[model samples]
Target: MSKITIALEAAVATVIENSPKDVRQTARQRANVDRAFAGILKLIAPRIRHFIRQYGLVAHWDDAEQCCAIAVHRAIEAYDPAKAQFTTFVNWQLRGELQSLRFRLMTDQRPSAKKVEATTVSLHAITVGTEGEEASLESMIEDENALSLTESAASEQMAGDLRAVLIGRYVDHLRDVGMEQLKRAARTKRPAAQDLAKPRFKAPNHGIDPADIADMEAKLAQHVHLVERRIFDDTCLDDLEQEFGIAKERLRQTAKRAAKTIAELAAAEPRFASELNRKLPQRRRPSKAAVQPAVTIVPDQHAAHNLLTNVVAITPEAGEPLAESIDARLAATLTTLVSETLN
Candidate 1:
């Protein structure tokens, strides 16, 4: 009955009547519709604000405003003059939006809810202490040594992966040593039972003696610990070699293997790879300390001919069956080694 209520109804009617159905509207038609919507929003602005306050959504005022606008747009699209007055229809829509907004704000998993809880705490407030000598909440919470849970978990996972790779290498080394001993026994025509009786490490699930496996595992654990310290703590290879009585070259070789294995592992896991890349120190460029002239050697035709003739003269003898058997055995061993490496 009021002029504002009549004007609001007219704007809603204009929207419903002029809104494009199956095709795009003309620019003029679009402008007319937009003007109608602007009028409707202006008329409902006070109502939206009132409902937001009514629902106690002060902390989320901006979000509540957005929700109210969406609710108004939906109400206009669905409104029917025959059913109820535009004022009544819009009031119900605003109420629904306000209720939903409140629910979202109060949900435990919502970031806004977390923020609200965070704001409730005062950093300077004395939460722990005895009377005069009290510590603030912020002081109690801060820790210099504390690492974020994500970074801590990532570091632990990376260390575990490194340990697994080291143990794998040790196992492979033991197998290689056992294989050589087995080969020697076969060449000497030793009995199979005698070969098994000797304390030699063999591939897992193969009929390796239990005592040998236990010993291998113990040695693997000790080697892994020492290698872990060397790789992670930047411990000197010389110190490890002297302390453990192992050759420094062997320790250096182990570190190289670890680097290669870690690269392959990181290639499979992007998250770990990114973390590793971020933590890796930048390599320094070598300084230009010295310059030397290049030297070239002249090739002699006689020497080149001799080298070619030497290469061409060598050939495998087809008559030697022992050589053929050896070749076949070597090929089979190589195939098995390749398959194991891939796995």
Candidate 2:
């Protein structure tokens, strides 16, 4: 049959023939079975590495490698090729082992006070980037001020109502057709005399006749297309296809059209640059607004008060040694509790 089937059959034959004489085999068959096991392990090692990376288990690669090896051995011993492919059976066993290891590692450690402090410091350092390349606190503040100014200028230029419609229709929910329909409905409801009496305005809306609402509609269509590309990358295509009942090819074509329109609008309009500059404020570096204060609350407040009072009242003679011991123990317990909470 297939190469896999042939290999598996050979492996099984070897295993059966290699069985010990007392247990049910010959030295020759045993050697063949051992050779098969080695061959299978070599073939699967790359697959194990690929799986580890694919699942973001790279940090635990060493343990995952060992687990995969063990899983393969177990699979070989228990495999029933009549019911399932050997590769499929082995994959199931490997997944189960890896998941078990993940659970064990997650649950085994009791978090300690030192661990919490270390994590907090690490997160703070990460926000500032690497040591040499980090922006100075002063520079960060200045950049923030510039961003805010740009945003205010842009906001002043764009009609508040139109900006809200653009953000709500395109940026937030990606309802391009719905946005167009809404605009059309609003135009229909506008007083008929107002619609008819324009100065018949024309260019330096740049080749786009300022008199034409068609040009603005065209620009809005382009903006929505650019946003969809950013939100849905290749990994999301399958889900999008399933949810929308559209073939992958059709969805891709639609996305491309939208992106092209957005690129055109960005290229054609001076206001686009100003708007982009304003939006830069939305991309500002995350601030410490959400940083939480570190605090420990003890349920046994009365006990804690008594202990503190006794330590404070200690006299030099008999109390000093006992108080030192109690202080050390209290410090250790507090450290452990803090660590667990932080973790």
Candidate 3:
């Protein structure tokens, strides 16, 4: 134990011992408590600073420091010397408050959270031209028909896999409830000391056992099936209630909670994220002239030159593969047309 721990222990003892009944009688006690708290805060200032730095709560230093003060106050009030040392007790409370502060500051709904939902982008939606072409933020950034057939098939397969993983999570959640029930039942079955003193041949194990494990597994299987039918299969809540003899409202709540959990799981799980967040392919769009009809120049006569016998097509400068060849052909056609007209 360090000097601060010793000081805190003494402070806690002073507060407990000097505690008074009436407000008028508490002046001396209040003075002592305040002195003790002052000493405690001074000693733990370094610790408070460490917590702020360690948890990335330095931006909210004032709030974090206030929380530290509250934790110190709460620790002094609630500390049981027999259970834990003052240092251990206060540090736990400090950590909890700081974690909560970090979570509050970083949650999605706040503009200060720096999350994507906090930012706004206008679509700038417009329609133009004879083809009724649409221009918008989505069109500018995203490619048309981004996913190929193979990728779509893969996403469907991954969806099934994600569903299976979510089912396992739901079953685990149910099993936790079952375990709690078993613990309560075991506690109820536990006999008194006198009952235990009267030794029988076989003493009952009033706790979870192999038999309970098997029974819980059996029930969990039924719950897994119920989750699949109600949530994944989209079976109506009333239908599930009628089939399972459970209340419709109860079934609905259970399914709702499971659905929420599934959504959280999908958001957190990387495989699900990769499958779900399919970014639009940023494919380069072909220029308008590339898709336009080729303009053909038909000459009346090929009298002087056999070179101009073939019909010529003039295509505009579009980002096409055969652009150079088309340009060369157009120049030849234009030269022949001019020469023949002069002739």
Predicted candidate 1 versus true structure: per-residue lDDT over 120-204, tens digit per residue? 4568897656566779988878885666876899999988886676456555665567556545544576435646567876646
Candidate 3 regions exceeding 4 Å error are: 21-25, 108-343
Query: What is the alpha-carbon lDDT for the whole of candidate 2?
Result: 0.63
Taking all chains together, each candidate's TM-score versus the true structure is 0.33, 0.29, 0.32
Model 2: lDDT of residue 263? 51
Instruction: For model 2, give the 10-residue run with minimal summed lDDT.
Output: 118-127
Alpha-carbon runs more than 4 Å astray in model 2:
1-5, 20-27, 107-343
What lDDT, from 0 to 1, does candidate 3 have?
0.78
lDDT of 3 by residue, 1-343 (tens): 8777788788778866777645454688888878877888888899999999998888889999999999887887788989999989999999988888877776654556575556444557554535677677666767666678668999989889867777776677677788888878877875545676666554354456769879889877876778789877999987898889999888888778778877776767786777668887899987666566445565446458655577656466544658777899999999999999999
Supply the TM-score for candidate 3.
Answer: 0.32
What ranking of all candidate models by TM-score puts the best one first?
1, 3, 2
Error of 2 at 289 (Å): 90
**In model 1, where do residues sit more than 4 Å from their true spots?**
108-343
Error of 3 at 339 (Å): 99
